[model samples]
Target: MSGSALKPATELARGNSVRTPNESAEYRRAREQLLAEEIELRRHIERVAELRRALPPGGVVTKNYEFEGEGGKATLSDLFGNKQTLVIYSYMFGPAREQPCPMCTSFMGTWEGKLPDVEQRVAFVFVARSPIARLIAAKKARGWTQHRIYSDASGDYTRDYVSATDADAPGYNVFTRRDGSIRHFWAGEMGPSTADPGQDPRGAPDFDPLWTILDTTPEGRGKDWYPRLSY
Candidate 1:
């Protein structure tokens, strides 16, 4: 063998040598560095959440809009339905769209499953720019009977909340009250973090506990993802 070359047996013998205490200490330091990075990442996320909570209240609702509900005609206040807080998810469905946006459909599915739990804490409803009849038809077709749905046919409510585009933009907004005044709390639009290639079809964050838990499995909730309306 060349002077610089070592046989496999010789290399194995050296590689099997025991590590010294100092070497183990260095390894532990590397591990600690990785742990520190994880802790820092968590802190950054928490900071963003705090900022969301700190957002100042926005415009007040000067106009009361009408909507058709399961019972009959309802107003914006009907959505709150005596609840102190409200969460409005502005779905993308409109009169012109051929079908409901798939991403919105997936999110609605998740919301449907969580409706009971959410109602126990705060009121929640899905809003769309389409007429009430159209919105209700879509919901029935999807078998989404759990949560309340509303129509922003007049578009006034969506526009006032900053969730609607010049035409119609899909968004999710949260609202709460302070000293008897309703206020905007949070708003989210469909984007890379919510929807993109190689992401959940529900168009939600990868940080969702449901997705995180599924990621730990061997098969890992494979890439072929879509929400099922039935079955």
Candidate 2:
């Protein structure tokens, strides 16, 4: 659906209402105003998605990056399995960290259950700079049975795609295979440098329901609070 074909957000919002016990007329009016903005926000989100889907061809992948999975050595092309598109989430679980990043763990937790559904359309896997055994251990610790995790033990793939310096930062990258050639498709570009004042770096249309649910509360993703491995 195009934004131009839609009714004015304000006009649509005007017809919506929330009734509550003894709600004042002033409160109701303000609620309606907020509703209008929400409608506009929804439209804006769809517009951004449309723009992303329409992006031109991305750069072709030349490196035959290798990783270690459950079945041993595998190349980038192998990660795609039988699918044409692959989504790799490079988490901040490097050899140096005694434990995986709490934030990354939180993010992966949300996708653990949904991977089965998502894989029906695109091949999805989790990659980390740690050894294959370590990555598997973390998966077991989290009780994640559905996520396909791999180890970029050589750090070649991490340095080239996840981080230029091979830092232990989280990354989200997508690739596509066409005509027997692989190409980098999209990646999460927002990071610490792009974060707004008083907010942490986050992806647009954040895949984590944790933050989304927090956003609906009055606290609004509290300043210092973060997920813990065990709490």
* Candidate with best lDDT: 2
Q: Which is the leading candidate under TM-score?
A: 2
- For candidate 2, the lDDT comes to 0.92
Off by over 4 Å in 2: none
Cα deviation of 206, candidate 1, in Å:
5.3
* Residue range 123-173, candidate 2, lDDT tens digits: 999999999999999999999999999999999989988899999988899
What TM-score fits each model? 0.66, 0.97
lDDT per residue for candidate 1 within 1-231, as digits (tens), equals 132342343344334444556567667555556555545555556666777777777666556678766667787666777787788877778889877887568667766777899898888888887887888889888888896888777777777674436356667677776577676667665565656577644533342444556766767777876555345
- Listing every candidate in turn, what is its Cα RMSD in Å to the true structure after a full C-alpha superposition? 12.3, 1.1
Q: What's the C-alpha lDDT at position 200 in model 1?
A: 49
